[model samples]
Target: MLQISLFRRIVIFAILIGGLVLALPNAFYTRVEQSNDARAVIESGLSNDDLSAVAGQWPDFLPSGLVNLGLDLRGGAHLLVEVQVEDVYAGRLDALWPEVRDVLAAERDTVGFVTREESGTDELRVRISEAEGAARALELVRGLARPVVTVTGAGASDIAVSADGPVLTVTLSEAERVATDNRTMQQALEIIRRRIDEAGTREPTIQRQGADRILVQVPGVGSAQEVKDLIGTTAQLTFNPVITRTTDPATNVAPDEILAPSLDEEGVFFVLERAPVVSGEELVDAQPSFDQNGRPAVSFRFNPSGARAFGDYTAENIGAPFAIVLDGEVISAPTIQSHIPGGSGIITGRFTAEESTNLAVLLRAGALPAGLTFLEERTIGPELGQDSIDKGKLAAAVGLALVIVFMGLSYGLFGWFANLALILNLCMIFGVLSLLGATLTLPGIAGIVLTVGMAVDANVLVFERIREELKTAKGPARAIELGYSRALSAIIDANITTLITASILYAVGSGPVRGFAITLGLGIVTSVFTAIFVTRLFIVLWFERRRPRTIEV
Candidate 1:
């Protein structure tokens, strides 16, 4: 007998109602989006009359999860940026200089006076007064070389040290350079992601394109320039020992000193040591706060190693000024009043609250390992996106209408049940997408349209089987039961094969391909549920109520 248990019917209706409720927000996407944004702001401890009003647009009891629109559907910024990985080579050598200087200085009797010499960007050159000690200096510096920390570079040293006359040159080895490049790219990607996420963007496609390039696509951003502004600042902060302050920008400086302009004071420059006492890499936390004068400032705290170094530097250099540099410009040059042991400090300057907040965000995200050169940039307009949405809606509506008409003409009353199931299947797809926070692209819309046609296949198979079974003199109930039972295997087999394909596409593909795979895979699951269970339940209910003895397909 065609029948569904009372509990099974309740479960089915509960699921259907739950899905419909979850998918309800998408029906008023704009209002719900504004409400969600306003609610987030309120939760972040900010609320105004306008924000409160906007937040009340949707009821508090409803599910607010939305199917995020992809770049193609929402319009956004696209960028192809190439990281300047070579910049790290110069910084690496600069960092290695202090170690080499200290090691050679310890053996001053043999090495004589040591001085850094001008060299290529990738190599560090140190000259000793005594030529006879060149070999000794080379040997000592070579001891500083460690094995590269990569599988392909296991046996290779990080630095190659060689001697020529009285000068010893140290350069990063090829293997180490390759490894450094990989790390640089990884770090750049992470920092970029962090910076964008901090700005509250959604569904950003940030992935490596080539060896040194990244592809960034942020949906719903105003322009590419806005995205660039968010990520362009390197935020490299360091505290350097100040040598002297000068008004002339043309002051000659030593090889180990750098002349940096003051961020707040015009025409004022500070000559500072190239090597920093502590760098921003050691900073564990940064927050927007007020300085002693109650002015907007950024408070920062360092890790243990950074704290120890910072404490030692301040203890030894009381009454001397230290320049707080960010991206090669000194923001503040404050004189040490006493030994500051805690490693917590305030950076005070002429700054507004917004600037301080943005700086805090950047500091928390850490500095980019290398600078980026924008190779390509594009801003997609909202008008174009709206056109795409309109077209996509038309395509989906047309596909749905054709499928509904075909099913109704072919399968009679059973066809109406199948059509209803198909509608619910779409609702379920949207519900699942909202629950997963999946992005919908143009290709994803195509997947939904394709699903509309495919959702009826199982019903078609069952209906045809019932027509055939009726020819064998089986009653309506027996024919219906056998039709569904016999068609189950075929339905499962066909959908399983398609699911495997969708999974593979999702695993290996990116961006639009991924969007398509997600929708297609989700559609298959929902279609099977609506076909085998939902349509069957509807038929069972009709048969139980009407108690029909004769049926026509």
Candidate 2:
């Protein structure tokens, strides 16, 4: 008779069971749909099974012997966005320049236009527009502005707006650029978060990177790809005159540096050739609406700079048309009747309520520094993702069935014990996954299936070893002891190789691939423990209980 202690048997069983428990949580419970009836029963102190019946239970927890589901199975949305701040900044700056120019041009327009004088380094030239009017505009402006940017030539009829060496003509410094970039990035992330959350998307991850960039990830989301259109439009606002090439001579002007927008288009509207009199950058807010004429439109209000620019531009360009263009598409063109110095106004044009709201948000949030050119876009339909999940499930089931049949036929009675151990191995896998919150991707499922074969391999090795030892006519106990000792080397070699692969995959891959690595690695570990110890425990127990003459292979 072979000599093997019961203590050793108990020790093996405990290790195997412990491993199974650890992996069960992650694997079997990918999602637990809590039923209120069940919960109420529990609260009312009912048995779990009774509560389950009253409410409803799911096989959602796959049999104790399977892999966990990953994000794909759980079904969620993933979105990637790049924060293009230049579009907003440049748009804002371009918008502001028009207003500033309009106000500056007012003095000239009212002054009846005069020659510009070159005074040393500073542009201290004068005598252009009406003096009193220029003073009024400057007084309104000098009250609130961007820091202490010098406004030279503000004293005379020609208001020379300048910050001296710090003129708008100069480029931004490293610090300014960096600061601006940080602010843009910061705003982009915050705004995006708000949008995603506002859309009722939860558990999102938003990150900011190099100069005005953000990355957002939303898990457990349905109806993917819709988030893109939600984030990228620029809502710039302006007021100008409507012009058609046929009616306005400038539209048919010689096409050279400034290409006259095609007059053939019904949407084409032109105003005075002069720059915009007011910018939307100064706009504090915008809301969509229906004008008295029953056209969709957006209303807006501006900050100080915008007010002065609007007032001055209107004062000089009175009766001239101004074009309100957004993202290269002219929204409207209206003639200036009276000066608007409040920095607030309305934009009336073709727009739906949703369209208007989006525009308003975009404008209120400020324009992007640069227009977004779709670098790359991919859309995953819900049906497609769901189909993948179905296929993955089918593959897993087929692999598992084959594993069971193969083990049962080849190893005979001993195979029965191995199958049991395999089930335990699966439990170990799921338990660990659930506890650790591991997601099982398709590759991860494959790994688990592959492990079924591997777990069986260990069993086959032990069984063959025992069968070989039985040739010497040893008792079942002695045969099992020798089999386990001999098989340990092969089992170690096989499982270690799998573990190394899992480690590499985890290290190199991202997202789902990483999920695969985690589950696979976990499978290898759980497989080894259950195959080596749990199987041995049952084999030893059988020998002790029966005192069999000879152990079957």
Candidate 3:
């Protein structure tokens, strides 16, 4: 048994009551207008004030429930994606590696990081490519890299290789520096998220898992396949088939000049009418929409020069086909679509509303520099997660009920004090989570249960110590003080060890593991507070009223 001071009891009551009040907004139903007003801004282009106007007001309410559950509990798709670094590098490598190979072979006899490949040398063997092409890819990769050192393959091919669990590993040649791989992966994921979000998904979670793998959780995603389909394929863009060289009206654009004309590596051969026109870079904005007649189309706007060039090009090659390519495959090749002098026109395709939006997303995010593979896809059903939650709740209830019975039987009136503290501890945990906006996953619930059990254990230690202290002829008050003082060291040591593990889990674990670690760590802190402050206060208040000379244990 233990006692608490009157002042402390009042303070505890006030704190608990305040916490519950503050947490009410996170648990109640919120309106659509409120949720929409939340800060969904991921762009820095918009000014804060401008963003504020579009974002609207903050939510005044929340869902009616025991706190919002994570995607696992509600059912959604979970994906582990490996960014296609290899494809990114392959484009640069395929185009420039040839130059490297040629330069290396021509300068084979040179020295001191020379670009020379000797006869009979392995093409991939870095001894040759490194000496010759090192500076070539180095300069280019640098342009795309962050403030990181240059990493390269043994100087052979400048290609991004493949993906490991959490990292998209690029060949040293393309990366120019090991550090850039992470930056590149991060950039790729951001692009992917933008593309997915443009298709209108809400509350999606995208995070880096390991060195190369990306974890994506889309809550309430009925369009799982669509997301994967759009993301897994790399939609790249490049300006090919330059018409600048054409001077004579009868001259035709070289086949190689046409940008990637097909998936088969064939280049386009649009009639050039011996005139140069604008490049695709003139495009400023593009959106997948419907044509004037309501046909599916991609509407695009171009700069001034583009408008003039496009108008001229169309006038000269009136009947020739101009291809609209996406990622190397031509989506449509409409014949001289009538001099769109405004540089704004449509490329019609067979697309549903969702598909149209996804295409728009891809364009808006900027095309990938290379190709990508879906490689793998996995979806987690919310039903399975709900089952785990149910089982976990059952286990927790049974364990808690048993603990309560044991404490009441072993410690009598003092046991009820521990139970009261335990209840307060639970309330504090929920309240804190509500304030923090942390999602409750299945593992997180497990942590809550574990905290409940551990919280009671502390009280048991104190009660047992008091019982033993009484045998030494100490009064109830003296025994209570001694028990707290003596048990503090063990309590701190256990908690410190647990905290260390929780920290590690938070650092190394991904997704649900991280969620669990967070709840568990917070639970320890709250447990200590309730066990020490709240329980002691209750005991002190009881002592003032009862003033028992002896205590039951």
For this target, which candidate reaches the highest lDDT against the unseen true structure?
1
Which pairs of residues clash in candidate 1, taking residues 3 or more apart in a chain or in different chains? none
Which has the higher TM-score value, candidate number 2 or candidate number 3?
A: 3
Query: Could you give candidate 1's per-residue lDDT for residues 1-553 as a string of tens digits?
Result: 7778899999999988888998999999999999999999999999899999999999999999999999989999999999999999999999999999999999999999999988888999899999999888989999999999999999999999988899898999999999999999999999999999999998799999879999999999999999998898999999999999999999998777899999999999999999999999999999999998899999999999999999999999999999999999999999999999999999999999999999999999999988889999999998999999999999999999999999999999999999999999999999999999999999999999999989999999999999999989889999999999999999999999999999999999988999999999999999999999999999998998898888999
Identify the runs in model 2 with alpha carbons over 4 angstroms from their true place.
1-31, 34-71, 74-76, 85-220, 225-382, 471-475
What is the C-alpha lDDT profile of model 2 across 228-309, one tens digit per residue?
A: 6655654444454444334343454311111233222564445333234455656777766677887676788777778777
For candidate 1, give the lDDT of residue 200: 92
Q: Could you give the candidate ranking by lDDT, starting with the highest?
A: 1, 3, 2
Query: What TM-score does candidate 2 get on C-alpha atoms?
Result: 0.50
Clash counts for the predictions, in order: 0, 40, 31
